[model samples]
Target: MTEQVSAASNAAVDTISRAGWGAELRATFALAWPLVIAQLAQNALHTTDVIMLGRLGPAYLAAGTLATTFLNAFLLGSIGVVGAVAPLVAQARGARDIKAVRRVVRQGCWAAIIISVVMIPLLLQIKPIYLALGQDPLATDMAEQFIQIAAWSMFPALGIIAFRSFLSAYDATRAILVITVLGVLINALIAYTLIFGHFGFPRLELRGAAIATLTTNFIMLGMMVAYVLRHRRLKRFNVLVRFWKPDWPRLREIFRIGLPIGLTVLAEVGLFTAAALLMGRLGTDEVAAHAVALQLASMAFMVPLGLGVAATVRVGIAFGRGDIDGVGNAGWTAFVLGLGFMAVSCTLFLTAGTFLVSLFLDMNEPTNANAIGLAITFLMVAGIFQLVDGAQVVAAHSLRGLSDTKVPMLVAIVGYWAVGLPISYVLGFVFNWRGVGIWLGLAAGLAAVAVVLVARFAMRERLGLMRSRA
Candidate 1:
């Protein structure tokens, strides 16, 4: 069965390699739309939490935002590490090495467990970290309460990422979409019931929200695991059988490729986390407003992120087959698509920023006017950087498909930490621009990274990025 699937995948790659731009565009879109929708649905879970917490008042929203920002930095970084499974699996399938695919998938699950063990303890220490950063004491306490439970979700959440990556490499993404959408609905319901004490539930507030997130993660992980076990094509791999067994070299390979990717993600997410901390120092309202604006930008980012993942699978397959032109076609097509969508979103942010930010707050509340106004201002800055944000992510993922990660990781660190973070600090503090200045710094950092990553992709051959792959 594995052999048959490999033959079919290899033949499909041959067809795609020979196809024209139009076909490539269609193929990429077909692979991308479900992923895009899944990403949106996944984000909606957090959006729902923010929206509800906002109703509890600005203080609650600010606290929740701080906690989630901290959690997501670690979450996304861990996911980036486990996500190496996608390209590894894609390359294996392209070369029709079914056994290798199984090994990668198995090791990906192992990687998830290892990351959870290391990260969960670190996440539990949010209070100390927040205090050291000089966050508001009350807000820090609230945030710690939220993270205590939410931290446990890291286990199932990382597991879900591993399985999702495996499914994506196979282009079996609709299941991911279905599972995530359902998770969003479930999370919303559970959060509402627990937060507000509806339906005889205790009003747990932030803790309730944390419980909802943890429960949802476990459910999503279970669904993904069951699907892999039952699906005709995936079941043959037995990804979970003898889960405790170790494949030392394969495990090392995942860490080797995944660690840099993880750091790259941390560099970018850490920039946002630092911005949140900056906002926390300025005031609760600034933190709340920043959260709203950032949420909107993150939601819009789902499109490019999905396209980036698609590009990884497509380019990985091409690289594995040694089809040089196919790699170029896959990367560029996704790049163009990402840029075009971001242009539209940029326009939306510029034209309707007020309306978008309003959706998260109560329009009737006079107290919300200040936070809403600040959020609109941040949204405008977010709009300005949309294109570059889209470009950097897509280009970086395309490089990952060719198993080129270390350079991009360095690019991210220099771009986000060295360039972006300093600009944010200078403009926001030294220049006294406040929230707007801080946002501009973010824009500057994204632009710098985007230009570098795009140029690197353009010069892939000249840079010898593909030399070792074949």
Candidate 2:
């Protein structure tokens, strides 16, 4: 039964891969919306933490913000590494190689586990790292406390990414959405109860938030694992049947494709993390404001991020089938969708900057005034870069569909570190523009990368990016 269903689904995807732009648009939208909502819900878990901690005061908010920034750098980097599963599985499915699909997923799981084991210890060293960077002593101490507990969540967190990548390639995103939305709701409630000592819970404050994050990731991972195993269509792959087996070549392949991806993600995320650290040097309010503004920008970014995921699947499938036209259609269609949504978001950020930032801080509290004001300013700048940020991510993911990551990784390093970071430091410190200056630098970096990536995709034929099609 599972084999029959899988065959039917693959046939449909094959048809879609050869279809026209209109058909491709519909397929991408079908695959993207649920994933978009899931991404938003996933981000909401952190947004909830930021909101809850905000009520505790700038000190707590600052600490939690710093801790999460540090942790997410590693978490997102690992996710990028494990995320190679989506395109790999998509390609295998396109080629009608179910056995290869299973191997890719199993190896992906191995990659996720290995990454978690390596990252947890480094995550635990947040205090020393922050102190070395000259962050506030109180905030650093509190951030370290949060990291001690939160670092362990990396296990379940990376597990969820691996499963999500597997499900995404199969176009089974509705399950991903349902599971993630439930996780968000549960996380918010747990965070509220524990952070404030409500419903007979202890007010663990920062610790409570950390626990909420850990608990939510575990639940989400379990739910994902159960879905993949119990769903008739998905279980046919038997992804974990030989759980103890090692496929060294497959593992190496994942790393080969995934390491640059991980570094690319780290470069972009690290750019923002570095910006957060730079803000910390200015003042607590500055870092706090940066967090709120960054969260809003990140939430809006989820739409394009989801579209990018869809592009990877669509393009990967097309690549596997040697449909160059299909690859172009998929990539361009996602680019259009991403740009359209970001234009809308850009307007909102520009028009409703103050109102959106207010959601994270208490307007009634005088102490929050500085942070709130700074957040509004930062958000406006974020609005300006929305289009470019959306462009770069989708373009990068589209290239991933073609297994064109190494160059994009190099592009990111150059655009971000060589171009963006220096501009941020000079403008923020040397020129004394402070937080706004740093954000402007972010805009520049995203814009630079976007231009290069979009051009790369445009020249795919000339660049021989399609030569690897199976």
Candidate 3:
């Protein structure tokens, strides 16, 4: 009788395992698709902005592009802090610690508020930096006009990111998608109106675009807050609890995990920002080509980037359950999927690079020829790095699942500064390979990160750090 019961129990466990796998697959897709579309829409906004400004002239295009890129570097770290809340909330959900989850959400929101206040001065200085880099005076002025007006939106933008992270953690992932779609439409309509002086709106040019984007972001924030408050499951947990007092220990813990991640991200942004500055020394055409390539790269990266984000939730949940095998499986699954997608992306870029470049370039003009050619060349180097780029991002999130941030930061510092930037400088200046040298340096840095992060994730899993759900 006991033997028969044991056999039945084993059968039940097998059934549960299969069911769990199915559920994870469903959840992964559900989480990934909306986020993926949202990312694409965000990229579309930049592309649309560029296209509209390009119609105005190359100088307008260059100015707007540079301003937005600088803003991303400055304000983006706040999103990294929001990221710290994801794993914490996921783990809290797994542990059924509703109080802890509520605390994390509120603290993350406050952290974003503080970051926005601190970032304002830095935002105002962007124009000076462009001038110091020797951009055309008119172009620099236009860029400054856009960036300064756009900086006002950082408060809501940063705060919304925290809210989004918390919502995703609580499995209210659909809210962000709905919000993003609405925001995208608003951006388009407002930009159209303001940029062209349509329907009684002021013809503010580049600054108009900035104002539209800012308004859309606030709208998105409002939509998300409303969703969370109305969410039944979230309401049951009282996830919206207002803290009469801040929780110091929990907030400190968040900063401890989040700050390093933010710095690591900032270091990478610094590398590219510095590269853009150095490219200015090369010439305006070089800067234009570099910006074009970077923007295209950012667009292509959205797919794998979304996949890595989904992997985080999967890994976080598995870790909370202490499922070592599950951690390995989830990490590898994301890695494989990301690599496959990047492989396709690399092929597409290699085959259609010049064609893609033409879409963003005013190729009808003889003056635009040099920039277009250089952009095509950059695509080759970018293609080489996509797989490595995908791998590193996936591995990084997998490691985050294990709650390992410090070592990842150390690795980023060495990979980006010790190796990438110096090699890029040598190649671009010393070897005179120009942009190719810079790209090769980027490839090398990403490869180092990919290898190190993968090993780290594996080591943590092997040590039984992040375990299975069942």
Candidate 4:
């Protein structure tokens, strides 16, 4: 009888383990594929702009690239704060609490607006700082003009993100994919027309790219808001009912969770932006090469990024449902998927890097050969870090699902700013290793962060399971 009981227990444990991993893999990729598509579409806007401007020459490419570096640092980081709502919404869904979910959404909108306002002065100040940092005056001037047009779109952009988080939590992933495809296609056509002065539009060049991007932001915002306002299913959430009412406590809670997230994002972005700035000190050719490599890397990065976000939703829901094992399962599953995908990216970057670099520049142009050659080298460096970068981002998002924000924020500071930046400066300038050294430092920083954050989530998962059992 004892032998039979032991055999039964072993079988049960095996079944549960299979079930956990199976659910996590299916659930995670189900949501992640659509998210990856949406992210790719959104990033393609920048890619399209860069490709179009590349036709004008390396100088034009540098202008758009330089402007986007600061824009990504400040603007994209602020949007990351808005994403804090995803976990909150997912938790609410798991608990079957509609009112709590709606409350978070409305509060998030207000936070987005407030944050957008704070960003204006910062965006306006980019040009002066770029000049002081000794960037090419012509490229800096072009970057300034792009910011002038692009800055105003921050409000709607953040607003779109708020709704996006809400929708993702409820598994409304298809909505974003549809809207994102439309936005990117429209932006590309409009950008081509405006940049080339076709269809009666004046040739606006780099500024036209800015305008095209801004137009898409507004379109996305309007579509998302309209869906929220009119959808019969979503109406019960009452997202618009207290549209103007302020909930200070709720707002404070979001900021408490979100500011850390924003700062974490800011630190990582700042590291790369700083590197871009340092490259600027080298020359326009180096900056242009860095730009192409970074853009390509960012494009491939969206896949792991989307998977990481899907993990946040999965883990948060599992947490709310009081399934601690499920949280670990979801987190680990996503991490595996993310790292796997990036490894494939690594192989591509290693094998066909020159061919990939050729897509962004005119190979026949003798002037661009230097920049293209430099980009291929940086692409190889980028390939080396893809696995670690994927793992770190996935781990960070998993932690976010557990309302564990502060530690990861601190880790980002230590990893990126302290460990990464100083090494970059020492190797690139002091040791005269140049651009390659800066990218090496970046790889070291990502590896450190991956180790730290993955360890944090592992510890947290055990603690959460212990508490649940208690």
lDDT of 3 at 376: 94
In candidate 1 the C-alpha lDDT for residue 468 amounts to 68
Q: For residues 1-470, could you state the per-residue lDDT of candidate 4 as single tens digits? A: 34433543353244336657886788888898999899899899889999999998988899998998878888878987888899888888888888889889999999999999999888988778998888888999989988888888899899998999998998888888998899889899989998888999899998899999899899988998888777788867889786899988878888888999999999999999999999999998899999989988999899989988898999889888887678778887888889889999999999999899999998999999889899999999999999999989998998888878898999999999889999989999999999999999999888888877877676673445326422
TM-score per candidate, in order? Answer: 0.96, 0.96, 0.91, 0.95
What is the lDDT ranking, best to worst?
A: 2, 1, 4, 3
Candidate 4 runs further than 4 Å off: 1-18, 461-470
lDDT of 1 at 96: 86
| Model 1 vs. true fold: TM | 0.96
Runs of candidate 1 with Cα error greater than 4 angstroms are: 1-19
Pairs with backbone N, CA or C atoms under 3 Å apart (clashes), candidate 3? 322-467, 323-467, 323-468, 324-467
Better of 1 and 4 by lDDT: 1
lDDT of 1 by residue, 393-454 (tens): 99999999999999999999999999999999999999999999999999999988887887
Error of 2 at 451 (Å): 0.4
- Candidate 2 per-residue lDDT, tens place, 378-466, comes to 99999999999998999899999988899999999999999999999999999999999999999999988988887778768778999
